[model samples]
Target: MHDPHSERMSSTEQRAAAGLAAVFAFRMLGMFMVLPVLATYGQDLAGATPLLIGLAIGAYGLTQAALQIPFGMLSDRIGRLPVIYFGLLVFAFGAGLAACADSIWGVIAGRVLQGAGAISAAVMALLSDLTREQHRTKAMATIGMSIGLSFAVAMVVGPLLTRAFGLAGLFWATAAMALLGILIVAVLVPRPPRALATREAGVAPQALGPTLRHPDLLRLDFGIAALHAILMASFVALPLALVEQGGLPKEEHWWVYLSALLVGFFAMIPFIIYGEKKRQMKRMLLGAVSVLLLCELFFWQFGGSLRALVIGNVVFFAAFNLLEASLPSLISKVAPAGGKGTAMGVYSTSQFLGAALGGLLGGWLFQQGGVDAVFLGCALLAALWLAFAATMREPPYVTSLRLALSPAALQEPGLVERLKAVPGVADAVVVAEEAAVYVKVDKLQVDRTTLERLVEPAPAC
Candidate 1:
């Protein structure tokens, strides 16, 4: 048996992981930079209504939602880098077009083209293709952290960048970043050592049934969608509210965002630690959703007070950050061992679609009844989610592990049970067709050395 430790990440893996994470960050930053200021700068565009402004803000999600899965599947058939390059080209073109446009409709058209790039899944797949199994989790986690960091940076930078160059300048900068991503893919990311012999790691048609029918996973999907919808939808009114209620300058809003985000993030740490340590994830999750509902109510109650607005920002973001960090792990716990990727793809698609819906609906509400109406809508969303989520069972206190397998393990009828018998393993599933076994285990209880040996097959005579 090949020593499990022998598969340490090579230089190529190190470079690929770093390069791909940077690439994902660049693209995400471009999309997010507009969020904090769109309601303000969108006013300068021709024929802009509150509704159309909201549509432009979210137009990218419409195309992104429609194409995310198809691009992932397409990458499998055609090749990862080719699809990525083409998508980047579309994004750059869209960004450039938006930069040059004078009208809101033109910006909307460009955003649709931008979303047509839809290369997130392809990039993630490329990350998988480039890294060893042991390093893949670390690689994916790095990319995830980059995304979260990018959003925080965009909040602060968007207003500053707009102050310097106006909204079109932001679009031009996005186009430049997209071009840089193309260069990164070509130069920084290394080609896989060999062509993949199978598509097992990619989402498959067979996994669709089990993933689709899952009640708990579906609830998580709804939660993610609701999360993003509230996020985008709130932007439709948040900035304007800050200006009208607090008498703050438009650019000055960044201070509120940056400070609130920092405090909110720090506030979330203890909850996360306590939830994990005590196996009380369900309780904290419910608490977070309830906080979301209250945040909206607080916004309505104190929309006119500057001090209250700042405090409200901190609390709202605190709750948002908590749920944002927790939801993915919750979904992973509920997903079928073999169908994790499919379930995540659906989750992502729902998230993008929710953004589109929220922007459209949120804008309409603001136009009809003002900030109070917008928050009321968000509160209703939170209420609905709370009602459904209340039915969910507590998340298992386990983390997932992936181990390489050999063909011989497929013929061992009792292998899964034997794996399950391992003291710390809550369950095990072997995908013989994929030459991999996945397990859920409590790290505190698992005997690491024993599990490592089991992951490798017995040497043949």
Candidate 2:
């Protein structure tokens, strides 16, 4: 019998979840900590063009985007811990290299290496291995919230750390954090249960094609890409604008970041509630995009005033938070049966690619014109994204459920049809090799008794 909501994680599961979330914090904060101070400190590096500086900020994303899927797939071949250990080593080395870097290009190279340590998919897969199915969502949510908190902390900490110890010191600190992460994985995280060896917790090559082909998923992918790119590009110009135009000192940048983030987080609460309670996610998404566009327009027009800068950031952060929180939910709702991981993998890739491009373009525009050019570039991207978002239809009000089946049931004639014929099952995918059925069901219309019988054991002769 499925426990559903009654499920409680074991002690081992809770420890594994928290430890893994810490690993994500270390990795993500390392990347995010440089965003606030890079434009200013990077100016001193050799051959530093605004474009090259921007690339250094976002280079990690490019490499991360390229490698995450393959890295996850590789973890399936080797043990998850070994792959993670190796990735952490790579990340630490990258951070150390950046710490010693003398040129913008060198920093860019180090950032690329930092991204090459792609371990997110592997980490999530390991989390799945360590938890029960009913508890997996909670475990994942823990990690998700950890990543969000890490970003917030980084925004506040980055400027202060850079002021105290320079850019290299920040990189060195990140290297140390990576080593700490390695220790966490080794000592605190438990090995996966034996069932994980053959489980479909990691990516399957077959799921890639269908996930890519889905038009609705493609729109969300593009949406994430645009969002991150604009975010990266905005920051490229934002810090310098606050310093030069707004007259805020570099050390005080944390005030802007912390305040904006706090405001945005609170401001987004109602929208999130509405998104869930009213099922108006599509409306919320479009509104958020429009808010982003308007924020960029404001920055472009009145970026010089300190007050205007604060207002722009607060509004920008609010929209950013809303979209960030909404996107994964939208992806979950839209992905086809048995293909959510694959869909998310593509979505993550899109996001990183956006970051890389956004940084590079923002820099180029700044070089060609000035701070205003970067704002204009961001505005243009937001406009296009808003249009793309307009085309997205409301997602189905269905939930995906996984059911384990006996092999005999897999071979039974009309099994797929029988599952589909169950009230409110819109789609059924039976992966015969896995002896499982992945069903998309509208719970409001589904008959619970009929659904329960599909997964019941066969009667003895």
Candidate 3:
């Protein structure tokens, strides 16, 4: 049987995937840069408070979540490049506006605008457009890695940049990066080849609805949203907790971030390997969610101590990495083939929206009930995710088969029926016009020799 995951990506597809991943990382870097320093920076702005600062930091996610799918669908209508160009322009404008802002409210407005770019969904859809069915997961994984790397780098760099040049200066630099991204999309990225581009029209709308309604998909979507919300919310709380509660200096917070990230990165490797290689994805995901839930509870209990908080951070990051890596892969496996883009579009939107909501709610919770409230809230969200995740069925391993057949054979009566009789063929769709057969089969049960024989040319009469 053919192995879909083993299929090699063409050079062009690799380039497109790499380019888009870089673009995504660049944009995300700008967003994450403010997380570590937002509270201190807020003090410099007019009408700044802890609650408002959290909102300002998180406002981008709210807008991005809301707009991600709309932008993605727009890409489908106009073209990917046009939508990407528009998003970059919006991002640049938002960054520039924030750079010039003198008040916390002004920064909040800027963040909201920044989120309005919502280019992630569009970029992902474009990636799917550029890659073949078999190679799409690898492309998506590349993008996922960029996101994780961007966040890690931003945490280390955000504080250093704030110390060197202040928050406004950082915003100005982000604006420059956004402008550069626009130029890259316009000039560096090649347009999709004609054959690949034409297939967009054949993608049906029904696939979108089913994916959105899927219980498993919704669970994963909610998981992403909650994960980001907790992340953003934690940043809102962590810096203050470290400085005020833990006696750590503001300038030295980067050390804490650096350590947590290093530990999280290395710790996540084994679990990720087990999930992908051992086929224990569901079990691993559940374990991670359980860990997150327990971590939140521990944070609620032992948040007063610096060491406790540090240990909590370690656990949180480990779970975060696992969930981040696994969620999209799960979506790819479960999403209908034709509407994979739409499914991801919805998933991305939820993720951003969750980040925004987490910020808003976390800020409000901090104001109303202090650090305990935020942890309790996060714990509750994680519990819900864990429960939902537990109910999800394990997705089977999928493999796609491509067969070359003669037009004469396809035209012959009962040809399709003959092909269907081959052992271990779960589903077969013959596109005679393309001289290809698309087959879904159980990799363990299917025999390659048997399949080849079924499609072999007939002997001379």
Candidate 4:
């Protein structure tokens, strides 16, 4: 029979996970809503050159990358809800500013402000605070799905919205969404429960040293950066290519985006399932990276053919979705238990940095070398990522568990040693003042019943 405690824990964790994901999706939707239409829309504004248009499109990423870590640290001091509310307010302000802008430079400034609202790191840290260690991976996965869904929706909706109401209207809508998000934060999300609010002793700092010094973690971080860079760079070129070479109108670009997203979603599921269930995550990741490289190569080879471009887009998005979902999980698995938050903070920062650089660099490259050179740059990034990815060790599946014990129990000689010796327990640490035990265990082999029995009510009590 299944344990009721376990079931109840699972359900609560799922709710918290879903709630956090909704928050992320709502925020991302506002940002992504402009990407598909930005290049064309910028033409209507004053001083709208290709470089300025690219700046408007990617400026948010620059601010986001710069502020992610600081926002996370701020959350640690001022609390998650306060930081999130501040971010939402900043985002709304930027949206409203962009909506009123008559110049491309003004819009670019607004986008930079929008990016400064960077709350992803805070959101992830909040998830860590709310959920048990055993369920953190599942929670993060839900957030990943929310991001992917938001991106897909934004790609389809961005062009249509641009056609229907124009760029200003879209920005106004985004402002409205951001305002709504603030309401959700206030009315919907629960206050952090007392048990979850208690900090564990011995948890290490999540700093640049730990995040960047580890070879494997650094590899994953670089991959995320490169992946996002390619994505942003592709957007800089693809719209013009579609209109000029594919003979597609600007408004009809939505159809291409919708089709690619749909096809990619369906095609990626089998590979993702295979990776998780068959323990072939490493191999699948490498394969996905290879597919991305191939897509870049194809784009380079068939720059003028609409059919070939569409095919390449489908393959690219499929791989992009797969990597987006898997990379965080891989980071969580491989990171030291004490520093997962730091590793993720670093990863998120790198991702936005890449986005910012992609747009700026893509604009320059497109202007200088045209479409072929753009794809060549993307291919080179993918090649470097593939090499680094190939060298990474398969991440072991482990989960962390937090247990509160009496001071006497902790003082009991060899208590931690005994826990460490338990069948699946990989490591255990006892924090005396907190009267807590942090345990790392292999997911498949952990015997919850055995651990629970050890902590059962004392005879006198």
Candidate 5:
């Protein structure tokens, strides 16, 4: 039977969760603060062109995507905090370099360096070490919330900062934030035990092959890539549109983003509730994707009018936020037992790759045909993603569990088969080297007592 009292997160877990969430928030805030104003203000740099400016905006993603997994693996060898410390210092140095740059290419180089400081996987590994398995979902959710909040704050703050202090000032502020993040991690976060640090938190090289080839996982990965591509591409044109076509003054752009994000956030709540509580995730996903497609089309067709642009943005963010929240949950539900870390690593890489491509494509299209071309291109990408999403199977509603195994139990043959034979147990993977069983089970139908007894079998009479 489940113990209700065991569900509460311990004080140590709470501190670790809060500290790590703040670390993630600071880093994300630095990255995102440049997104809203770069298209407009970046033009003032020497040798700036439509394509180069687009590259400047998205250059970090290229390095980030390529190095994210490697950094995580590095942490496994050296320890998580050392990797984190090095990543933050590299990020700060990159931001300082951007702050001092005089040309668009210099800025791009700085952004590339910023992305080289990839620490997302390392941070997640540390979080896994700090919290028990049962409490991990809550810890991860906290970090997710922090990222979402930072993005919202960035949308409003980016323009205001640029207006106050110019493009270089924004990069300077980002450097300061990265430094602050280092301090937070050093002071607030505890070091994980050596044994727990190397646990299931880090990626397993052996799991990567199967994780990459998973069809459903591939679809979701493509969906994220497309979503980010559309985002980066739209921003390449959006700031310019707001000033020229929409007649929104440069200084007042923050209000539009503030209002749109607020409306979109409130609008997303009902769909989230309907999707999760009612188990209508596939329907919710399809509906959100359909809504995203229409909004892109709306941008392409009517973006010239300020009213239409504002309305389109409000709706766009509504769908974007929904899809952003839903995709990770779906990945978790679909991942093979003991393989989620690898699955998520690949998904994140695809997402960054999409951002890099989106920037390049958006810039080229805009140069060829202006704002209309960019929106049209995004619409086409959205349509392609919609087609892929339509074919995804309804994901299983199962929870993953990890249980330790005794030495004697490890010697028993057919242990995995026996666990899978239990009612409501969906899948089981027994990694003998780790002396652990990773299980997937339907909570409603699964008998906890039976599951527990099977994992730690009683001594023979």
Candidate 6:
């Protein structure tokens, strides 16, 4: 018999994880490639203004926020691949439109269309369908890492690519990359064994209200919104400052981004290790937010010096990366038993909305009071976030688990209670329809063998 507790991912599972991660990387890289260069090159476009440039930068988030849940639901109805294909095609079309556009308004229209694709949910659902319960978390983490890597790479690559090909050329590259993503999904990803009735990873409609209403979850949602808002707003000003005030040529912006991202990524690792190992997540989170607020102030005061810009950026990203990595893990921990998917959905929507608002506000501030106003505005946002984060209690340090149930065990009326009684299982939810139990367990204390034995059927007599 196969070991239920085995951590080894099957070869097929490896292929699925790798293929999906690539899809995520390609799509994210495409979207993020414009971030560092747009504020500078975008000015040359017809009808360009700081406000319009910001709108163009953030327009995609509005569409992505609106459509992601619906697309996830649609994938359940029709099929995962169909939804994925459609989203990618739409994204490609949008990129092509932006690539050919001569005006900022047209670019904004293209960005909205790009976000309309909203394939993230479908891609995740497909991953859930393909992977075994034992290794699903690992698979999801792989995809998450790919996304973060893509964002960092985009920061460094955006400037180089923009200098070589201009803003329109960058859009064209994204369009090509989207098309490449479609091919990767078709050729490389393995088909699932069957379509399961319950998607443990996909959003659960009934859980949405509770997920949103939970006070801690609400704090997390607000935190992500503030985080992304700050990111979008800051980008709107950073490029402009580097070129206009810091006396750095636009083409050389890549080295600054490259150096800062490398420093930030390495600096963030130890904080994550300490926070998780020591269970000091709340303290870590609060500290990161405080540092973010200070970074904005640093920019507001001494941004004209190129040296200060580099140092401030490196520090800002370290905090930003730490918070970005922590928030989702915190969401998984704080979400109600069996409501993780819904909680994440709400959190994602909040994040995108924050990004949209950030771009708009950042542009408006820059227009009104130059880059200094943009930094000041971001500082105020960071301060508000720090206040909100300060009230959050420590998150329960538990890992989420999904266990497949035997047919006989599925008939047990007290399944949830029995599972809950197991040592180290903090919470349990049995989805009888799916013949599975989702549990949050404290690994250090959990008796895995006993829990599995209880869930397994009795031997034949």
Predicted candidate 3 versus true structure: per-residue lDDT over 67-127, tens digit per residue: 7766766777787888888899999899989989999988999999998888886787688
Query: How many clashes does each candidate structure show, in the order listed?
Result: 0, 0, 0, 0, 0, 0
Total clashes in model 5, counting residue pairs 3 or more apart in sequence or in different chains:
0
Cα lDDT of model 2 by residue, 7-46, tens digit: 5778888999999999999989998999999988899999
Model 4, 1-461: lDDT tens digits are: 43534534554566677777887888898899888888766778998877677777888999999887788777777788888889989998999899899999889989999998988877776777777655665677788889899999999988998899999889988888888877766766556653233232112352457667999999998999999889888887888778878888899999888889999999999998998888898999999999999998988888688888788888889999999888977876777644555677778888998888888877777877877777888999999999999999987766666677775576677777787778878767665555676676676887665675665345664
Which consecutive 10 residues in model 1 have the weakest lDDT in total? 193-202
lDDT of 3: 0.78
Span of 10 residues, lowest total lDDT, candidate 3? 194-203
> Which candidate, 3 or 6, has the higher TM-score?
6
State in Å the error of residue 361, model 4: 1.6
lDDT of 5: 0.88
lDDT of 6: 0.90
Pairs clashing within candidate 3: none
Question: Which regions of candidate 1 are displaced past 4 Å?
Answer: 1-9, 195-201, 447-449, 455-461
lDDT of 2: 0.87
What would the TM-scores of all predictions be? Answer: 0.94, 0.95, 0.86, 0.90, 0.97, 0.97
Pairs that collide, model 1? none
User: Model 1 over residues 175-241: C-alpha lDDT tens digits?
Assistant: 9999999999889999975434232235667778888788888888899889888888788888888
What is each predicted model's overall lDDT from 0 to 1? 0.84, 0.87, 0.78, 0.80, 0.88, 0.90
As for candidate 6, its clashing pairs are none
* Candidate 5 vs. true structure, TM-score: 0.97
Ranking by lDDT: 6, 5, 2, 1, 4, 3
TM-score of 4: 0.90
lDDT, candidate 3, residue 52?
88
User: Candidate 2, which ten residues in sequence have the lowest lDDT sum?
Assistant: 193-202
